[model samples]
Target: MTAFDAAAEFDRQVRTLLDRGHPEAAGLTAAEFGALLAPLRETVTERGGAAVAVAPEEGRVPFVLVVTREVVPVERAVALTTLAGRTKPGVVDRHFADGDLIRFTPTKEVELPDAHAYVLFDVERGEEFCGAVPEDAMAAIADRGRTPLTIEEGIALVTQYPAALAKNKCFSLGGSRCGDRRVPAIWISQNAPKLGWCWAGNPHSWLGMASAAGRAAAGT
Candidate 1:
């Protein structure tokens, strides 16, 4: 498939997984999952590779860890990785630095490689991913004179709420990245670095490796 076609497919899979509403719905967070595959697509485009995820009519992901430089066919790309997972770590790790952007709910979290192992985020310099949203004085969205938003809406609305926005979901999960007790960590882009959540679409599918309960709640 073409790069745009692949991205569209990836986006569809994420939406499908999110729509499942399964609590185990906990899979890779939207950013994590998106970051994981986008780069592969880029590389594929550069190399003219057609390798991409086969549309999953079912829940199970038939294609995982696609790596190719381009000019390669999807079938060939798929078969090549089966030879050895040597390139897997580089792609995965590059996107998951402890300080990299991530998302998590009560079920699970998508942590970057360089993040704080104990905190599930980064703790270097002043940047840290507490992995939870801080409890601010604002009650609920309704309390703030607004309606409760869907995950996608919330992601968008949070951007304007200085007190409510975050770089990481660590704060939402109930934790403090720093001792300041001031602000929760923000979720940064895994690849883009400083960019934060745009919520271009809904994150109903935002999840990664979830626990049984999380899956149930997320409707996975």
Candidate 2:
């Protein structure tokens, strides 16, 4: 949990995306995707701190490479994510099988860079809000001057640190909304990852609202 090689970590993330066929989904080759991300290396190196993914209360900040839905559809990205040697692809809940039907865009408060991809820093698991309603947790997050994690950001966290999506500690993506009460969330299922949604007004003892200090688009 000490400071890590920022550049190296960024490289590893790029490889993860490539390995998971992100570029292919986006109609680009691995090399092309690499080229697309090359400009962000310097920003990552300059902004990255201790290589940790848990909330800052744990004493270390975290950063992740985020490819927006524009680059690779959320459903595709989820299916590409894996748990170590597992061959099972992540699943999207039946409710959202038609990904196109859900326009789960980032909330107004979550200002992502204009680019297709970016980096999120100071990530938090939001365990402190476990058992709190998503709507309430969001207000608390805003009160503290923090931004909630969007679906893309949440996926990026687990895509980089699978262990972060643990049992009884999964988080809600309050930063993304579909004009209804459903709040997206990522959690472990059958040893693989799953993208699902829960009611915004409801509270779960195991689900907390994940958050970030801020984000920066790649190449900016």
Candidate 3:
């Protein structure tokens, strides 16, 4: 779509948020709101996604949303939040790995099914998207007594029993820490073991493997 068309769509989304009683939008004048959407509009046009404005609660500043077709990495999400001038931008999805966002908020305020259980803000999209895990799946994982696998365990599992990774839907969350920096992690889904090759023998090791695993799960 043309930049102009994208901007119009963004404006429409913002208006919808306002109509939904977003307090942050209530505070901003139309021009100010437009200014906030400017960067996001350009981003969506260049990147081919949608943008929205999330109203802040309890006196927080409103954020510009930058929606993408795939799950955004934590580092990239942080960068997007920084670019948008928010200390903590929201990064929402159906499933999240540890470190996908620095913090997570569980809210029933979102529109997606089972999203009321938990949601992450997309710093780039500036709003929540329809990717949060459904409530049934969360319950199933719990019922199966499945806990997040440690980095070592994940590596061992993939290395020793590669096929089992996909069959058992075994995946790891965020446990790999790289020095002082925390790499943004992604959820490991049914196809995790196949992702090992992406980080196999890499210096970052676990973190790379987890990142690749998340991408594969998200099909990004």
Candidate 4:
């Protein structure tokens, strides 16, 4: 799609969020959500098609509207998520919810702006890295100058584009790691999207690491 088309697509995503009542889920009204995105919309329109242009050549996710934990906790975000055409809401793995022991903080390389709502650009599903170890995939992604997706970003991804989390095409959220070997991921479970984790050193043919070119406040 052309740059203008990409921008239009971005707008459509924003509308999708509103249509899904995500703003209400986050305790914000539609007007409030619109107000929050006003500046980002200006920036995106001004750039024309720069957002899509910078994406990876394949499986590029042009943009995603992310509502951070500050606005809605991860657990709540997971509950709000749903697979396409399915009424069953997405879920957080019981393991992840166990005592809240897994603190999936963003890796040092993935810097996010200090805003409850922002946009991630040029994301990729990392299908080429399928069956590669999460740790190794992270290194390869960095070598390519891309940053991995955090749990929040991963949720935002499938939240906006549920089809991206297909049966074997699921992705790992390498950007968020606990202080251990666990690498968080999102996949299909019982026909619904699920937030789970895998060992950092392990590899899964169905799961590839997810990454993004960068993140920025929408208004920026």
lDDT of 2: 0.80
Query: What is the TM-score of candidate 4?
Result: 0.90
lDDT of 3 by residue, 1-220 (tens): 2233544544665464344323232354655544543444444444332212433222111222322212223233222221112233223333335553344221222122121111112111101111323233223333543222223323223222223222222232233333332222222333222221112122321222211111000111
Predicted candidate 1 versus true structure: per-residue lDDT over 1-220, tens digit per residue: 6324544543453343333221122234655544534443343223222223333221122222211112222222222111011222101113224543223211113222211111010011111212212232112221333211112212211221222322332112122122223222123233211212222112212211100011000111
lDDT tens string, model 2, 1-220?
A: 6645677778888888887788998899888888888887877777634533233233124677888888888887888876645677888877775654358998777788854887887788898888999999999999988899988888888777776777788889999998888999987789788889999999999998998878777655
For candidate 4, write residues 1-220 as lDDT tens digits: 5333656766787787787777787789998877776667655555545565554343567777787887767877787778777878898888766655337788777788855878788788888888999999999999989899998898888878877777788899989877889999998999899989999999999999999878778557
* Residue 120 local lDDT, model 3: 15
Sort all candidates by TM-score, best to worst: 4, 2, 3, 1
Which one wins by TM-score: 1 or 4? 4
**Candidates 1 and 4 compared by lDDT, better number:** 4
Error of 2 at 11 (Å): 1.1
RMSD of each: 17.9, 2.9, 18.4, 2.4
Please name the candidate that would achieve the greatest TM-score relative to the true structure: 4
Q: What lDDT does the true structure give each of the candidates?
A: 0.23, 0.80, 0.28, 0.80
Worst 10 residues of 2 by lDDT: 51-60
For candidate 4, the per-residue lDDT at 78 reads 83
TM-score of each: 0.19, 0.89, 0.24, 0.90
Model 4 weakest lDDT span, ten residues long = 49-58
Q: List clashing residue pairs in candidate 2.
A: 55-124
